[model samples]
Target: MEPRQTKLIIFTAKLIAFLCFAYLTLAFFPQYAHHLLLVIALALVVIGAGSLLKYKSQRNWIESEAKLLSSEEQEEEIAVSQYSKLKYYYPVIEYAYSANGISYTGHTLSHEKENLWVPEVNHWGDPTPATDRWWLWFEPGDHIPVYINPQDHSEAVLVKDMTKARRSHHLALLTGGILIGLIWLTLVVLNYTLPLR
Candidate 1:
């Protein structure tokens, strides 16, 4: 599926989940809302923490000197329907670097674009590999900064600024988790003190 389609599906699913939870708490199971909310809040907090920790681990890879060996634009076609087709564009890049006297070849730019998708549309508002935004970043035989694992030289990433977006995403998750937890706690307190009975 296209990236936009996948994002839409995920957003729709989250909205539906929130609506169902709200209905249950407000109308059908008011007495159990506190407990349910607590569970949901805890789940979000745990997921957020896990994401933050994973991002931190990735951030530990030290910067290294690497040179782009080759860069190629690749395309794949997907049949959206009998009458329409979608074309996705991506850059295939190979780079070489040395760490600890061992030379390593890496093809990974970043995990963010591993599954990036671009639909065949004239006006795409979202970030898509089809645009020059990504291709313009690097060229064949260009020297690029890379991050490599000190212990394992073979593991490396070619995209230097990829961590900025990743950090923001994890920070958002942590913030969302804290907000949800606080909201749930407030609801629990109000349930006990307001004397709705």
Candidate 2:
């Protein structure tokens, strides 16, 4: 099995174990369930807000010109089961920039996670041909816009805020917080307004 498959299996197992434990706890200690959910909702809200704030701060980073050093595609195949497998393709970009009279090299394509897989071939109704990979967009020695951290010259990225990936990530975090908050509020209102059995 692929390492990715192992990691996914471990994560799924951990999540399932956690959910089972939570269910068992709530089943035995029903009185504390409300408080547990409220705490979880508040923690999610805080985490979501902090993530958005961190992303927002990246927008203030200064832009600098960078020379493309290399661009290539990384391919990985993960076996889903005995007769099924999934292939993922992502771009690997390397660029160099100068800041504060110092030169630095960066390999990040965006403020988001390092490994971002593009849509699979013919997936999601994508019209782009499989032959056209993201790495084909640039070549060595080409000039590209790079955002540099003013406080830390070593940190930089080729893409930043408002990209589809970034937007979706933030939106998901925000939605999680909102949905949990609503559930918490509704439960609180019901606990107070509705007659207890």
lDDT of 1 by residue, 67-176 (tens): 88888776767777899777767677899999888888998876555234344454454544435446546776788889987667788876534344555666677777
How well does each candidate superpose onto the true structure, as a TM-score?
0.51, 0.68
Residue range 40-62, candidate 2, lDDT tens digits: 66666776677677668889899
lDDT of each: 0.69, 0.73
In candidate 1, residue 174 scores what lDDT?
72
Cα error, residue 146 of model 1, in Å, equals 1.1
Worst 10-residue lDDT window, candidate 2: 112-121
Residue 171 in candidate 1, Cα distance off native in Å: 3.1
Whole-model lDDT, model 2: 0.73
Off by over 4 Å in 1: 1-36, 46-60, 73-90, 114-134, 137-141, 160-169, 189-197
**Where in model 2 is the C-alpha error above 4 Å?**
1-24, 43-48, 75-88, 113-117, 121-126, 129-134, 165-169, 192-197
Model 1 pairs in collision: none
